[model samples]
Target chain A: MSKKINLTLKVWRQPDNRTSGRFEVYPAQDIDTDMSFLEMLDVVNDELEKEGKDPIAFDHDCREGICGMCGCVINGQAHGPDAATTVCQLHMRRFQDGMTLVIEPWRAKAFPIIKDLAVDRSAFDRVISAGGYISVRTGAAPDAHAVPVPKDSADQAMDAAACIGCGACVAACPNASAMLFVSAKVSQLALLPQGQPERDQRVVSMVSQMDSEGFGNCSNHYECEASCPKEISIKNIARMNRELTRAGVRS
Target chain B: MASSNRTLLQSSIVRKQIVAVTGLAMVGFLIAHLSGNFLIFAGPEAFNGYSKKLHDLGPILWVLRIGLIAALLGHVVLAIKLTGENHAARGGRYAVSNSRGDGGFCKKTMIYTGILILVFVALHLYDFTYRDKTGDPTIVEGVNGGLSLGLFGLVWNSFLQPWHSGLYILAMIILGFHLSHGIQSLFQSIGFFHDRYTPMVKKIGFALAILLAVGFISIPIYVNVVRTPHL
Candidate 1:
């Protein structure tokens, strides 16, 4: 038989960003240890649906954690108590029987709460739209060796490229700074040859857009790196700084 | 396509760089100031001589003062602006917000300690420079027949009162708190630090902060405990 546990959840619920929110406690009974965290929430939500109460609204897609869609502060952690694991990937076994979890949406001015445990992350989309893409022409597939990247640069770029755009960095920051996320996007391209033509313009535009979207500046608290599911390095922020500084000086 | 009219000042990162550079300038000033204060341990003659040399610089002294004031203004103004931006970034507070490592004390209370340091600087100038200019005979005395505060006498007399010494000591501690975080942050802000050397950098910052606090506090302690009032 599957090991089952009963838990209490203190979940934040609000109709919109303008309205005040409060914690709504729900009893989660007979939760299977093999189920993922989101699965356990699903069970509670199912019960709420049956009772004719407003079903708890949360964000989740590609429950395996790749989509960057599912996230919430589980017991003050951006993605629950597991390191480098998203909330959707966190299994029920991590929690013991009778434990209570406090769940809340990402609380940043850039990320307004849409409903219970769901925030409007369109601000991220705006930041990305500002400069996250390479402006190159479409052509036939070139040889893989045609544009050979240095091994170290490739690895570093890949490391930064792993960022899932989860907004966890912003959520985890004390100042709600989007530096880690923005830097990841900037570093991923800035390290590559394909991203060179517009590198200077990209960094400046993206960073300015980030400020326009109302994210705070990085103070090197390292909390964003700590909470990132991808383990994105705060060094990426340094790279972004170097890029921005050089671009500023040159122009 | 679109006319993007963004100046360097409009960029948040650049503003931070300005803050970092100016902050480090102030740190440099603190180190020099602390070294000068250390001359007091060599006795009043050495201390007064050091003060006399500084006072003799005349117009150059005004240049240094203006430069320091400009740095202070840049640090304080940007700090205030960045703080507002930081506050606005958080839509609201979490009910059960918790953090680990750098998120604690020094990182969190930067603005508070910074404001305290500003207050301390104001009081410090008033106690040492302004008082001397006003010809307040109680706070000034001659050294070797020269009609000046003798720097050493000014420091010693002010620290003679327990309350004055207490406040000065407290301010040094606060300055230490500010520096511990400020030093490393300035490095990171200017892109000179990384995680590989982060532990070492943090230790350096901590050591420097402790040194400043202990170094500055030693003066008041020495004045109260060891030095005899001589004019």
Candidate 2:
């Protein structure tokens, strides 16, 4: 049998993006240790609903940790304190009974809080739309062997492709830089042969979009890599730098 | 084409490259300076001769001085601009902030240490380069057959003061902290990364920081505690 524990929750509450937010205390009773952190929040919301109070608002989807829809700063760490784990995957067992958890939304000028925890991540979409895709024939899938990707390049590309578009990197960075996210997007394409045609334009456009959206410059803090659920390497950042330089020289 | 080139230069990454390049140039200047300062250990004759040789470079010395000043200005101005942008990016402060242990004290405190070093450099130039101590008893007149600026005597007298030596030692330690993170970061900014070589570079950065700090500190310690003034 899994052990049961209680937690004192201090969650940020705001009516809308236009309003200022403050922490509101809520008691979480009999939370199972095996319960995921979001599940524990679910129980708290249920209790609030039963009492005819406005339930706490948070963003979560595909509780399996792959959707990248769920995340919040838990006790000063993005996606809780567990390394390489998303908020949906974080379990209550990681915490002690009666511990106080301070939860807040991703705080960045680019990611404004919509209500309480959910922020407008449309900035990332804008960056992606800027030049995150390769132009190819859309009707049919190309044969795998036709591309002739090198094994080392394929593996590196796969590693870079693991980013889930989660804003944890922005939340974790002291400067709120999205370099890790932008770099990963750049590296995944730059390392592949299929990404060759528009490679220069892609990096330049994406980086320009990222900056225009008000994200900070990378200071090489490596905090994004530390807090990232995908454990993305900062080497991707260096790769993006090289790509930008290549693009600049060509232009 | 010109507009695109201008855009590339204005981009955040390119600005960082500028900072990194200028920072490395300053580090180069520091290394050359520390090497020249080491000649003080060889006694006043050799030390003053080295100063005379540098002064004899004349126009070349002016070129170097101008280049160093340009690098310093570029580093400072661009760093301040980026720092402001970084501050604005994070719209609000975290009520309870904590580090993930990724960047330690030295990495996070770059601006503070850099500012301190800037202040120290100004004071150092004022004390040695710009100051006139013509009538001071500590001055060794007619040194290096009157061909040198009595730089050795100036340095020796300055370091002999406990407070002056202490200030220099403190500034060197701050510079060490700045370079420890800076040396490795410059390579990263320039897009140099490798599985084996990056780690090696990091180690070299740390070792160089310690070496520079210790080397610079030794002069003051020797002057203040080790060497006895001629009575």
RMSD of 2: 2.5
What is the C-alpha local distance difference test score of candidate 1? Answer: 0.87
Q: What is the lDDT of residue B63 in candidate 2?
A: 100
Chain B structural similarity as TM-score, candidate 2: 0.90
- Per-residue accuracy of model 1 over A85-134 as CA lDDT, tens digit each: 99999999999999999999999999988998999899888888989999
> What's the true lDDT of residue B70 in model 1?
100
Clashing pairs in 1: A109-B91
- lDDT of model 2 at residue A214? 96
What lDDT score is found at residue A160 in candidate 1?
99
Deviation in angstroms for B230 in model 1?
7.7
Per lDDT, the best of the predicted structures is 2
Q: Each model's number of backbone clashes?
A: 1, 0
